[model samples]
Target: MHVLTKVKQPFNFFTESVIDLDAVNFWLQKINPLWSSNKALGKIVQKDIAADDMVSVMIQINRNFKFGQAGQHHPVFVAVNGIRYERTYSLTRLNAQHVLLTVKKVNAGIVSTWFSEQAEVGQLVEFGLPYGEMTVPKTASPLVLLAAGSGITPMLSLIKEMSKTQQLKEQPVKLMYWVKNKSDAAFLARFENIASHYANFSFHVFYTQALPADARVNASHAALVTDLANSIVYACGPSGFTAAAEEHFAAAQNVQTEAFSMSALVNDDIGFVNVTLLQTNKVVSIPKGVPILAALEQQNIKPKHGCRMGICNKCACNKAEGATKNLVNGAQNTERGNLLKLCVSSAQTDLVIDL
Candidate 1:
């Protein structure tokens, strides 16, 4: 057996002077484009149109680019004018040296708007380690992927990956996608092509904002998910869409959901509740059904968080007293010293939490 030795990096005052890891890494990266390390780097090549307000960007990765599973999110960092912003997007691997990132611009989303209108080719960007659990399951049973709006990005990744295997062709794979209109439904042509090639795979696109004269199929969830008893389901979308789909698939034993939006339409009366933060010893009055993270942030208190969707437990805090409600499944809990994810948890009553 032969072993290769690794070279050690020499410390330098030029790029190593900063104490902040991110700051030092940023300076080092900008100073030397050839400074190869374990960090991954990608340069923008082109932005192709996927829909009216959606774009599929091609990025060329460095030699150290880490490979992630299909449906995993890529933490993207870019500088707009003079300020830097970080956002996450579903990334699809095109080849060993290329990847694709899809983004759908929101009404006022800063980073997404930049990707649509301001982002230029040949621009370098930083990507963190991928994170997500809403991937294709490892079972041979039927699979149901539920996606809404830009949530279809990850589903596209799963489609691209599963197409190479015989498992998808042998079993039933279906996609339930919802969009505002036909123009916002990205990748419809590709999905139609895939369905044409594979008999076991199929998809349905639901438009909420418009009904065209000619339609492929009605956007009906009940009609699409007729066999949910023996299938693994994955869903990603806005909070309202995921919440509804969650209720629709509540009986399934294997259901995974991801929602990033902090906004939701309150059907029931949330009213007001008192929240007591033990660390800061501050009391605030807010609605009952909103996430505690948003309530605190409204009062100008910042909390540590990642993904903001309850997948990463970065915002988990202990509750010493009082009841809480999970905004995702609408589950209620009242236990002492219970670890609750603040990003997805809302106060049910007068509460005392160790934030």
Candidate 2:
């Protein structure tokens, strides 16, 4: 009898899934279960007076918040009675799990009030990831760090990191900290400790407002340049202060600068000029000397900005159509068909911008 052999059908494997390695890895990392735990959840630790008007709020974050490379800022979000506010502060301490931020309380800032008056230990706040492109280079060249007022925060981080890692031998690092007074100096003890410990590191504290009684030698840009001539210089401060410093270091080839506000663009009389927002088709007259960003802000329209001095590329907008005059250098630089920095450029004519 011929056995009815069941013809074994070959397995088709039609429903098998093929994974794209890159996509699989991306989703695995982005949507991983651990991601939820890594979100910024802040725990108020302690408060200490870093200076007369400046205070340090210690925050303990969960899930190992990524530490910045010496000189970077993290935006802290605070909520009080359901009102949320955010402000960016530079990390004063480097390579530490707990983040320390020093803030000078503004007269009427919401978050500043909460930090100065309401914040308590163990209270939970929110903090964004570390951001800012101002970072220390991994070079062995001589380094010059300059800062004013609270701008010294990031420079402190860089000095501390260099001291901790014994990296001073690789480069001669000098700090030129400019403050209004002795009491306005933030992280003085830490800076003194670094200066004392590292022979390669030098500290020069300049008091622009008033010199301290205990100050042996007053600090000046000329003094710093005399010591570390032709060295790579990094500076941060208010726009006016940075502008003055920048002028001093203009001859130095290796000078880099970061400013808190673009106040330099706000001159005496930046007369009004008409600007047309290309995307919105709205024509707004902006004062010539006043920054275009400020004009937008006055109209209740907030434009993205960082340094405001044409240094940081934050307030860059497409000049889809029209001409502009840059008053800073008295140069009639036009951008009829490209991106322009609204912080520095004023509308020369009825201008169109991709707002």
How far does residue 210 in candidate 2 sit from its true spot (Å)? Answer: 2.3
Residue 318's C-alpha lDDT in candidate 2? 82
What stretches of model 1 exceed 4 Å from their correct place?
A: 1-38, 212-220, 223-226, 251-253, 267-289
What's the TM-score of every candidate structure?
0.82, 0.76
Candidate 2 residue pairs in clash (backbone atoms < 3 Å): 270-288, 270-289, 271-288
Clashes of 2: 3
lDDT of each: 0.80, 0.69
- Candidate 1: deviation at residue 208, Å? 2.6
Residues forming the 10-long window of minimal summed lDDT in candidate 1? 213-222
lDDT of 1 by residue, 113-137 (tens): 9999988898888787888887767
| TM-score result, candidate 1 | 0.82
